[model samples]
Target: MYVCPEGHMAYKKARSLQKNSIKNEKLIFFFDVEKCKCCPLEGICHKIGTKSKTYTLTIKSNLHQEQLDFENSDAFREKSRMRYRIEQKNSELKNRYGLKKSMSNGLFGMTIQSASTVFIANMRKIIREIEKKGA
Candidate 1:
């Protein structure tokens, strides 16, 4: 059983396997859309007179499900603190190192600029550590 984006109950219509070169087996879940048409929130959830209403969800195999479970676990919340720190670092880089505005054009130039900015940020961190130790 799967719920629609608008909280409408949708029954499972079909399930199939999708082959990919990445070695990850993808499972496709097809949900019926017939119930969606009669939903009270149909005006908000979907446009009127829309045809072929169906929802499909593509998920990976056991490993991906494990990952999903972990993401919802309390351990993942603690791990996500690191993500907040990383986001702060990114914000600092963008604000202080002119990363928000590109200094060069094209993909290669952008890569060089990003690498240099990160290198400078790391160097600054190292310098701050050294200064603290010296003090």
Candidate 2:
């Protein structure tokens, strides 16, 4: 079972459970993003256009009403800190690698360009790691 960031239900068993006779994986959905656009609690429980838009969810384990505690939880805050890193990496790839704007015109050319960009990025990361180690 994989916990989606949107707190949506997901139930894909691991390879070890392939031979098992289990029918349903029973994935639970939990989250506090009920004020966001996709949330059903928006406009009813909370006011519109709030500055502190807190979007969070948990699906691996069931927390019931305890999910509210995550609002002020240290672990949650730390996890949210990773949002910037992810956004930064996405922007870097999109800008430097031209991920969204492919130079290739056809399918084959696009595939080659994508592969080459990934390879180049990986190589750069490896070189940076080696340089760091030497330093």
**In model 1, where is the ten-residue run with the lowest total lDDT?**
23-32
Candidate 1 accuracy as lDDT: 0.76
Give a tens-digit lDDT track for model 1, residues 10-121: 5545655445554454333344457667777776766677765555566566887898999999999998977988899899999999899988889999999999999999
Provide the clash count, candidate 2.
Answer: 0
lDDT of 2: 0.61
Instruction: Give lDDT per model, in order.
Output: 0.76, 0.61
Work out the TM-score per prediction. 0.45, 0.35
Residue pairs clashing in model 2 are none
| Deviation of model 2 at 123, angstroms | 0.6
Best by lDDT: 1
Q: How far off is residue 73 in model 2, in Å? A: 18
lDDT score of residue 22 within candidate 2: 36
Tell me the spans in candidate 1 whose CA falls farther than 4 Å from its real position: 1-79
Say what the RMSD of model 2 is: 16.3
lDDT string, candidate 2, 54-84, tens digits: 2233333245437658867999899888989
